[model samples]
Structure formats: C-alpha cells, structure tokens
Target: MKESNYSSSMTGLELAREYYFQVGRPMLEAQFPEYLPKIAAGLVGDGSECLGFDDEISRDHDFGPSFCLWLTKDDYDAVGEEMQHAYASLPGEFLGFPARNTSARGDGRVGVLEIRQFYGRYIGAEQPPKSLKRWLYLPEDKLAAVTAGAVFEDSLGEFSRIRAALAEYYPEDVRIKKIAARAAGMAQSGQYNYGRCMCRGDTVAASLALNEFVRQAMSMLYLLNRRYAPYYKWMFRGLRDLPILPEVPPLLLRLVRENPLRAENAWKAEKIRNPYLNQADERVELIERICVGVIEELKRQSLTSRNDDFLEAHTYELMERIRDPELHMCHVLEG
Candidate 1:
C-alpha cells in the first residue's frame, strides 16, 4: 500500500495512503458498505510526496500513514459521524508504524483529517470555488493541499471535478501580470543585483541576489505556462515540467551554484593580471547571454500587463477562456 515515491522513512502522504488502503478503507467496506458509493480517494496534490520530492526530513510530524475520503455535502451530512467512528477505530498501527495525533479525529495536513474538513480549511467553504475570482485569489498551496495526498474512495466524483477545475491554467491577463512582475524581479535581482553585490565585495549579498533571481524566474515560468508554483523547495522541480522554457531551471541553477559570483570574479581577476590567466571576456559574455535569454523569456509570454493588480483583475477572463464558462459576466453586462 506504499507509493514508490515514498522511498524514504515514509511521508505523511505515504502513511496516509497505507492507513487508507490497508486499514481505514477495509473498515468502511465491511462496517458501512452502503456509504462507500458516495466516497472517493487517492493522492494527486501539493505535498512533497505528491510531487515526489519528499525525503527523510519529512518524518518530523505530519509524516505518517493517511488518506482522504471526499464526499459531497449531502453525503457527508448523512454519514459523517458513522465514518468518523469507523475511521478512529481502524487499527492505529500498520506494519511497524503507529498513527500520529491530529487536532481532530480526522485532519490531513497535520496528523490525519477527513476530506471535507480539509477542503473547508482552505477554500473557506467545503467543495470548490464556484467563481473565477475565488480560484484566482485562493492560495495555490491550499488548493494543492486539498487535492493532494491519496484518496481511497471518491464515489460521487465531486472531488475529481474540483481538482480538475483547480488544475486549469490561469487567465492570459493574469498570467501576463504575474509573469511581468516576476520577470521584472528576476531582472532586478539576478541580472542587476548579482553584479552590483559582486562589485561591492559582498559575495553573500550576491548569492542572495542569485537565489532571489532563481525564485522569481521560476515563478515567471510557472505563470507563463498558466501553472501554479509549488512550495519553494520544489519550485525548480515544478518548473522542470513546463513545456515552455524547460531549460530555464538547469541554466539558472548552473549560474547559481557552478558560476557563483566569487568564482567568476576571481577568474576575471586572474585573467586581468595575466593575458593568459583565463577568459575574462567569456564570463562577461556568458552573463549577458543569460540576461538576454531571461528577457526574451519574459517577452515570449505576450503578457502586456504592467503590474500585479492589473494581472489580478484580468485573471478571470483568462479563466473563462480555460473553462469556457456557460456565460461570461462582462459579456452579459456589455450586451
């Protein structure tokens, strides 16, 4: 009942999945067969396991056997208590591991939680956001967390719909706005700040600038593709999946770790002292090339928005394009 990606000690997701398939799910089937049809399960979400980036460090607290059981409001209200009793009663130990403590009988992100409560914590209402504004404004991690982890049962299919809807790419104007802002930051931090810090003899500051540049550029790539950025640790991992600007992460990382400012400057100094020390011109040329590519990546998105607020307003229109909603609000008003 363990996911292959759960190669480490065992992630919260892995433990949850194990608990669901091995213990919790079987209990439901035998004790409450009728309610089974209204539930759904499995993991496809925001945590480190959902992305396969989890490791030994994930074992501190939330890491353990767990799973989600999603139900519509109608179904949840009817059998929620019965399910809770059954869930709590499931053998608290699996293999050699024991279930951890949660705030409630069932909480997913922390200890273990029922699916409905998990959704309610993030969207401010169980079920998914019904409006584009709700989707735009909702934190990507919250949405990711809700849909993430494994689901052992999903009979009504409501959870799937919400996940699919949330999975959609952002609106064009929103994408443009986010991309523009992030790109501007990347330019300022990576292309501009790194060099400034280096000249001021502040290698630490320069390193910080490179890190910032890497993050902003990664966010820009996610925006360009209309995808949500994952948590910071997996930001580069997330960027690698984009069909657009796929090479950005590797090149950026290379710039950050391999060609750090101190190393590059030292090389330049040696080259200046002796005609044959090293290739100073090459380092300068490479940096300019990186900047040029970054600027061009910003341009290719065709995002014409000027600022973050402008991007925020236009995000929904882009969503309409994605969802092809039955009736567009602005269009109705104009008509």
Candidate 2:
C-alpha cells in the first residue's frame, strides 16, 4: 500500500487563513457580492488555534480547515443558513487537512455567526465592555482569545472596531485594582504562608503556597506589561514575552521544580550532614528573592514606595498610588 502522508505541518492559524484566502473569500465574493461588504471572516475562539499555539499534535480533533464567518444581524437573518451550508460544503480537505465536525449553531467555534453573538460567546458582551464590573468579571483568558487570532478581513468594520478598542488594555483604574489584588495574593502565599508551612514540615502545603505565589506573581507581571494573561497551560510560555521581567519565568520554574525537600532526602540517604537544617529553607530563600524582584519592579514603575521585601506592605503601598478615589477605596483583593 502506498504510504499516506497525514502529518500536518501548518499551524492552525495559517491553515485557516489559507482556507479563507484560497477558498472562503473567493466563494463569498463570487456568489454573494452584496453580502461581501457586510461580512467578516477569520479564525477565533477558545482553542489553541486561536492563540497560534496549535501544532501538528493539535490536529487530532477540532483542528482543521475552518474559519468563522460573522455577519450583521440583518444579513444573518436574510441568508445565514444558506451561507452556513455553503461554508459547510467547502472542500472537506485542504492542504492535506480534514474538515471540522459541524456542531449546532452557537456551540461550535467556527461557522456562520452573528457579529454580536460571536463576541458574546467569548466575552459575555456583544459589544466592547465599558463598565468596570464587565471587564473585571470577564476572565483574562477569554479576553486574550478574543483578541489573539488573525482576522482575515472585516469589511463591515464592526468586529474589528470592537476588537481594536479591547486590545488597548485595561483602563488605569482596572489595572491598578488588578495589580493590587495579585500583589496581595503573592504576599500572602510567598511572604506569609510559605515559611510557616515549611516550618511545620508540611512540604505539600509549602509547595502549594509556592504554586499560589508563582500564579499570582505571573499574573502581576502580565498586568505590569499591560497584557492579558493567556490560559494556564501557556502561562510560562506567555511569561517569556513580558517586556518588564522576561528573566522571571526560568527562575520561577527552578523554584517550583527543584524541591528543597528532595535535597534533604538526598542528604539523609547518604547519612551525611544536612547542610540545611530545614529542607524547605532553600525554597523560602528563593521565594523571598522573587518577592524582592517584584518589589524592585514596583519601585521602577513608581507603583510602590516601600524598600523592604514584605509584599503585603508593598501591596498596600501600591494601592495607595492609585489616584482613582473609588478604586483606592475598594478592598485590596477586589480583583
């Protein structure tokens, strides 16, 4: 039998764009010229493909030759099903890739969609959110997904406009609030509980505290860079791109991956002196060091005034820098 070559080497975003320019756009322009100016075409949603993180391994399921076609409400009502059927009838294979399985409208990531509905599915709002609660309630990952993917073309202009506005980053007050909240979390986990847990010989709990500290610290870095943190799986990958603290990710990985407890074990196994009395003492040292870096960045950004490594003190100090009286008045953990 002739060997079948099935390994897809193209990224999902590239595949979608190829499908759009080669087939989708031409089809729309030739068959429905009137709707061409009113429609938007692109690949976007909750998948790794939307973030350009999709690789060959991502092609096992929803990964395929597909793109979203968004239309104004009136245009959708007029020919939505027809457009959907036409899009569905597109070549089942393109560039050696298979077609995506169709799902009911509003359920699947790609297909004919109303402009408002498409945005709503991701961010819980049909339009760019203007209120603090709306932005605060929407998860950063969702916002990242909404703004990450490539939009092939948006002749209607509505989708791209909303996207542009949202890409501007959080408002000043919102950013301050989020920074305050994450700083508070980092302080609690790294400065306060990590040592106590270690002293109690609760290695597991100490590790958990380290995890929480890293999580909040990473979020704070993204806020400092004025970018939304991507999904948890890509957190470290995303961290390397931060302009303010690109060196932090590797240090963080080391702190988490190298267990001081393991070091103590190796010492006990050899029947030699335990160089460190507390197995977790090294971990605590690393935690404090990370806190020190955060504090330096806070000072550099003029977000805090404290010189010490007490993150909770810095947290309050940073909150005091927010000029918005209402935001300053909100609880430190509000975000």
Candidate 3:
C-alpha cells in the first residue's frame, strides 16, 4: 500500500471513527445485515489512540485506520471467524493513510473481537469484578483502559453496559481505601523521608523518594476527583484535565525538575549547611503545600476531619470513614 501526501489535524480516534463509517460500516451492512444490530463498533483498548493521546509519532507502528467490532459470545461463536475475514477485506487505506502496521502484540487490537475476551485481556475478567477485594486489587490503569475511547454504537448493549459500570469509578469504600493508601505513601515518601535523604547526601535515594511522593500525590488527586489515572505515560495529560487539585501538577513538575543539591554539594553530608540546602528546603515546603491542598479537599469531601499538615494523620481519618468492617480493619496502605 502507498501512503498519500494527505495531512489533517485528525486524531487516531477520529480517523478510526471515520474509517468505520466510510468503509467498515458499509461492508458490515452489505455482508451481514442480519447481525448489524447485534454488533458493537468503536476504537477501544491498548493504544495511545484509545486514550486520545496519540500523535504523529504514534503513526509509525500499530496505527492507522482501524476500529474494533465486538460481538456477544453467541454471535462470535457463530460468525467470529467469518466476520474477521470480511473485516480484513476492507480497504487497506482510508483518507490517504496506509493500513495499520499491527505489531505482534497488536493483532487483536483491531478487527472482530468477542466482548468477554476483549475485556478479559484488560481487567482479567469477563465482566467487571463484583467483590470489593477484586475491585481493590485490580490495577487502576487497566480499569482506565476498560472505560477509555468512544463506543460509536452498541445496539446489543452488553459491551456498553460493562463500560458504564466500570466508568462509574470505584465504589465509595474502595475509593476511600485507595485514598488512604496514597495519603500514607505521600506522608512516608515526601513529608517524612525526602528531607532526610537530602540531609544524608543520598541524592539517588532522595530523587527516588521525590518520585514516589509525586506518584502517590498524583494518584491521590485522581481519587479525590473520583477519576482513574491513566497509565503513567499519559498521567500528566490526564492530570491536566482533573477538576480537583489543578494547582498540584505545576508543583509536582517543579519537584521533579528542580534539583536542590548542586553537584559540589551532592554526596557531601558535611556540606549540608551550604546555600544549596535552601533549595532542598524549598522543595520540602512545596511538598507541604501540596499536602495542605489535598487535606483541604479531603475535608470538603468529608473524608477526613484532621487539622494536621502531616498526611499520615489524615490517612487514618480517611480509613475510619470506610463502612465495610473487613476493609476498615485492613492496613491503611493495603489498597
């Protein structure tokens, strides 16, 4: 297939949608009209495209005009293979773009897929996990993927139903537990250990501690906003759109980018009292500011009533709000 010189501001998700309507839809309507109403078509699962974060760099591989066609188990068992063949016969190029260069891991990303199999690959279940333990243990990024992308049509409703249930975000008890974990993590890594590592001249350990603090802080922001953070690569992009703690991102960025210790002062514990020490002190103060912002949100949400700058204190208070006996008794960091 030859690539055209065509260029547009279209995102991968938009390209997939247009491809489905212009080519995939017509073929399905002509060849399998009887099953049209039962089929679900959209661009979903396992791609920067699915998350609406794809760009020119995303097109070099596992990209281009493609969308998923999901079918119920019964419909799949009957026509899954046949439908895939029909899908393969669709135009290799659409809107002047070449066909998707599907890598080995991307084979199932496009074309006909069974609904259960499609979800199972992401969340490790045919349906959303029902038990609290299952919900707590499932990875947040996987849950994000399960609910990402646009479902253009789902006449049968099975696929959309699962997506909707997962999209409701975590149950209240589970969310509280997760928030408690993040609070404890931020307290331990940022508030407690960051300055200690800097004082001890362990810059590597100090950097790692700051990274942990940032990770925990980001997760806490998402939980506070009642949204799932996407995979780490797209986290900042996702974070930018979150309604709560909008100021926290810039502080987190400064925490990661600004190195408090100068090269001459690094790994020199005896020189801790130098001018560079003030930079480290500023980062610690910044971390405290973030903690304060989170604490304010926690109070507003009635998740905690603590009046402390230390996040570990609030962690216990948040856990106390958990109504489930089993969950409440579990370790604050279990989630």
List the candidate 2 regions with Cα displacement exceeding 4 Å.
Answer: 1-8, 101-107, 263-280
- How would you encode candidate 1's per-residue C-alpha lDDT over 126-147 as one tens digit per residue? 3566655555566765655554
Q: Which regions in candidate 3 have their CA more than 4 angstroms from the true location?
A: 1-7, 263-280
lDDT, candidate 2, equals: 0.79
Better of 2 and 3 by lDDT: 3
Clashing pairs in 2: none
lDDT of 2 by residue, 152-261 (tens): 98877998998898899888878878988988898898878876666566778877888899899889889989998889888777787688977677778888787667
Q: Cα lDDT for residue 57, model 2?
A: 57
Write model 3 residue lDDT over 1-335, tens digit each, in one string.
34555536778888899999989999999999999999999988778988888877776789988999999999999999999999999987788788789887777888999999999988876478878888998989989887888899999899999999999999999999999999999999998888777767677888898899999999999999998888998888788889888999999888777766663263343434643233436687799899999999999998888789899998877887899898889998898
Model 2, residue 292: distance off in Å is 1.6
Residue 274, model 2, lDDT: 33
Looking at candidate 1, the ten consecutive residues that score lowest on lDDT are 326-335
Name the best candidate (by TM-score): 3
Per-model TM-score versus the true fold: 0.70, 0.89, 0.93
By descending lDDT, how would the candidates be arranged?
A: 3, 2, 1
Itemize residue pairs with steric clashes in candidate 3: none
Give the least accurate 10-residue stretch of model 3, judged by summed lDDT: 271-280
Query: Rank order by TM-score, top first?
Result: 3, 2, 1
